[model samples]
Target: MKFFRNQIENKKDKSKKEDLAGASASASENYHSLLECLHHTGELKSQSLVINQLKFMLIYLETMADPEKIQKLILPALHKCMSLADLDECISSAGSVKTQSTREAADLLLEGYCLITVDTCSEFWLLQVRADIHRPPLEPENEKVVRGSHIGFVEDMAVNLRMIRQRMANKKLVFRYLTKGKETNTKIVLAYVKGIADEQVAETIYRKTEKIGADMIFSPGFMQEFMEEHPYSPFPQFLQTERPDRVMANLMEGKVAILAEGSPTTIVMPVTFFSFFQSPDDYNSRFLPGAFYRILRLISFVIALVLPSVYIAVIAFHFEVVPSDLVIPLKTSVSGIPFPPLLEAFIMVFTIELIREAGIRLPTPIGQTIGIVGGLIIGDAVVRAGLISNMMIIVIALTTVSSFSIPSVEMSASLRLLTFPLMILSSVFGFLGIMFGLMFIMIHLCKLHTFQSPYLEPVAPFTKTQYKDTFLRFPIRKQHKDKASEAGGNKANK
Candidate 1:
């Protein structure tokens, strides 16, 4: 209450200061006579008309005011009126009437839409301005993979649209632009194939985007929370790809893509679970390594999400399930640990998350050093100090490693967040909790949709032909032109 009162007093002091400032500003002498001097207003008292209507008056007026004294005086806002009046007219003609403030007065003195009044001749100025401020093009940090195309999304929306369009040569590929931000006029574009993509998906993208009412939106990530299909779900409902080729592929898959002006990344909508796992490099790189890497990523994703919880559940309640040989090792590792297995696991996992978050927020070199030094110092010290068991450290390290394996940064973030609740669930019900959580996850995955397509498509639908790309990648010829494709079964990129 004391702090609150102080805060209120501070606000009152600020208001009084503002009021004093306003009073000081308004206390200045009225420059009405000086303002009148800006124009030769003959109607005002003490008017010193400068421009002569007659040649005789010009010389006489020059003499009336001392020539040396008049020479020192200057009119600041003086502007020559540009008007078309008939030279042949004797005081009147059809088009000779001066169009002053009514028709075209705004153009005088390089005015910005404000009308310039010079005895009332108006000139309308055409005013148009584009954004002058722009962030320099930089490689997308979110979607970095060693072997993939180095060209990532930049802040320029037009450049992003061109990158995706260059890959998708189909004339049916449509890019629709809309103006957002009431004051900023931020340009946002939605790109998709006209016929190849589903019409409903395009509508959904536009509808969701139109509803975004933010004071400012910097990245596609800004729109994610407001426009997501499931607000409460941890999984990313949209797939944001830096690679244009990846976006083009999603377009072919009947999904809609959104590109924000001044944002380098393009958001592909109705993204499936497989879309996050798949990458442009997967299609571009050597098939065997690519397929193996993709499979490993899926495995790691599961491990990242479940490893800690499994360790806790097993150690806390399911010890009978462990082999006798392994039991001694586990017992020895956790022997001196004071906390329960569940609490120990939580401590390690939470600490790892804290380190990861810090690393992400820190500068590149510093962040890398922190990740390395922090991991080594903390893990070694904690285990040696007997604050946490070695097994707990291993489980946390593995979980962190698995979290990093998923290709999509956003998807990995979603998976990482889910680890905590799952950990808690496992702590209480053991394997039953694991089974229930997995079932819930599966149900949620089945229910989630991006645009209009099921997020767990091909897998949920159980398409034999589609799994060729999901579980493993079939060679291009086999996927595109082989006998199987000709048999009207394969439609991987179509």
Candidate 2:
């Protein structure tokens, strides 16, 4: 009986040893497979360590994972870890996840997570140690405002989301994450306020974003182009801004904001024509000043779009429309020029565009110097050579200044583009041509829809309630009262 008991106990111990051996072998195989699949990239790093008498491996991408974090947090935790439960307790990372599949573990490793493999354990522990790689959120040069929060969005998605959260501490603010770009696997976040944002609009944006089949989405512009309703339209369907306050304001108004990883620009959807003209400075100032500047910007838009065309029409066909006193001066200015008014305008406009392009491409101080010196030299030389008229130069300069007055760069660019068609029409058919071009533009604006919202809005669809905040901003107190009354009326109707 005693001999039989001893043999049975030995068999049981042998079985236990076999089970441990199998687990160890399986873990080792998985680790080797993961390494093979990840390939031998320069940034890929692996460290072997002995923890609590068990063989362990730490694998991560040096470019994506923070080395200091692994040293300070992960190494100490591993030393204290006697078992998986101890690891869970001792590791400081809140985003640690466990996976047994080699493929899943490899994916985690690429995403800046530190992967821990224990020789006798099938599961791999993923620790969040992503590198903090982004610049400080300094105010964007293009989106500068005279008054308001100077903070702007950074390239880091996590930091951008935190900025939004810090500004608007509302529970209703929701974020939906989606991955796009098969090759890039870029992270995208759709942010909107619940109950305020139209569910259909949000869903439309999400569906369009998810359906994109591109292999690489590097910037917000790429996503914007893919999701825009009117891809061919010169006007931007989405409002891209770097300011957090601007994004917050749009969110409050039931607009959706799309943020992409690795881009500082945020794309706001369903914006109207007036939205592009709006500046944070408008709201920061008193209602009167805000309204004045807003109206001025609108006027600037018209001038930027039609000023050159109007000049061409007047010079080529409608000399009578010019004030009798100024007609002589206009005639005198163009009399000595060799080119026709149309050619003259084109030359000056093209010259301005060249200077503008050069200025943008060069360093800041040098750019300003180039713009000023180049403009003066070129304008004087053209006028002296009689290739471009003095009057045409003045007109083109005014048009350029007017275009710059518009707050939105996209809209400003659109205006610059529209100028060419109108200039051609005005040169051939005079005022009638200008009128036809304006009519077509208005028709396009009215027909254009951004996510089913009228592009013109409040004006074309004629919403009386929205007028308070449209072209002319009413006093904040009065606007609030109107909103309250409007809400009350809505409730009563409901």
Candidate 3:
């Protein structure tokens, strides 16, 4: 029995030595391949070092790596190191890792990690030395608010994630990283609460992100177009916001947020038509005031979308609906205009759009000056010249104000565009045309699905329980109780 045991132990030792020899050979081949792959790039830099008579090579990209950290933290630690184990202990960065694959080492080098290769070791070390350069989290210009946290997302994904984690420290909040864009290789993060967010929804988002085949994805808009169910729809399927608080609020309500590197905007999915009208200021104020402003916004949506069309229809085909007292004055104001109501409407709307675009493209001070000069001077000159009617001016100005009141920029722009089609319909067919246009819009809203979630939720599906928070803000305690009761009912049913 002792002789057989000794023979077995010898065989095991020989097998172990053979495996070690194979690994060392593979590592040597991989090291050379990694160097050859990166040699063509101008930013690829390398240095050789001798530690206790052992040869070592350091490789990294100069544009992406931190020179200060390599000089102060990495080089000094390497000078004191005697072996691979000492190298690990001397540099204490948390992002250190070991790999034996050449492809993985090349990827790490491009991602701002320093690769350390030793002549006698079978694996290489990767140390995080990414450059820290980003703008401070200032308030986003387009999404500014009056009564809430002023912090907004920056272009850096790490800083954005840190801000989110700082706000909500719950363990349930989870993030999954994905890399898309064949050429750009942009990094995207999917964030959701583990239990609160639906598992199926998360899975769907993952599948869609994995299937994105674009070569360049520089902004959130690119991903939005690819992932949205209906790319041609005028209404935005995903809500884009730069506010971390807004993201946190949606995460708590079982929605997913898609954040991309190098973009400050975040895309929130499974949003409803009502989501575009909500503002953080609504929740920051008293519930009654919040509800009032929310309802006002919804009213503005109708006014902005259909008000100009209503005016055109009335003036062109159904002048009998006008009040008797104001009819004469309206006719008098419009009598001298040579163009028909349709052409008059087009001219003014087109002019307003031009002014709006100019204001956006120019610098802040110049844009403001252009808007004031264009609105006051051009509007008065056109009216005195009898090119446009006084009543039409009033209607167009009111429509512009209402469109501006919408909280979402995408939704506001959609409304502005939808206005023209409705105006054309009303001009041709009167009140009947306006009604038909509205019906078509309503049908589209009902049929639209964002990741299988109804776009017109709580209205088309007719959920009375969700009505408390849809068009109006309910009290916090009441809303929570309702949600808890609904959750309990769902669990019991299941």
Q: What is the C-alpha lDDT of each candidate?
A: 0.66, 0.88, 0.88
lDDT of 1 by residue, 344-390 (tens): 88788778888888999999999999999999999999988999999
What's the candidate order when arranged by decreasing TM-score? 2, 3, 1
What value does the lDDT take at residue 89 in candidate 3? 85
Higher-scoring candidate on TM-score, 2 or 3: 2
User: Which residue window of length 10 is worst by lDDT in model 3?
Assistant: 18-27
TM-score, each model?
Answer: 0.73, 0.93, 0.90
Model 3 root-mean-square deviation: 9.0
TM-score of 3: 0.90
User: lDDT tens string, model 2, 1-494?
Assistant: 99999999998886564334321234456555665666657676778898778787888888999999899778988898887667667764678987666666777788899988777577778898988888989999998999998989999999999999999999999999998899898999999999999999999999999999999998778887788889999888999999999999999999999999999999999899999999999999999999999999999999999999999999899899988899788888889777777887787788888999999999999999999999999888878887888788889999999999999999999999999999999999999999999999999999999999999999999998899888888898998898899999999999
Winner by TM-score: 2
By TM-score, is 1 or 2 better?
2
Each prediction's RMSD over C-alphas, in Å, is 12.3, 9.6, 9.0
Give the better candidate number (1 or 3) by TM-score: 3
Which wins on lDDT, candidate 1 or candidate 2? 2
The stretch of ten residues in a row with the least summed lDDT in candidate 2 is: 17-26
| Global CA lDDT computed for model 1 | 0.66
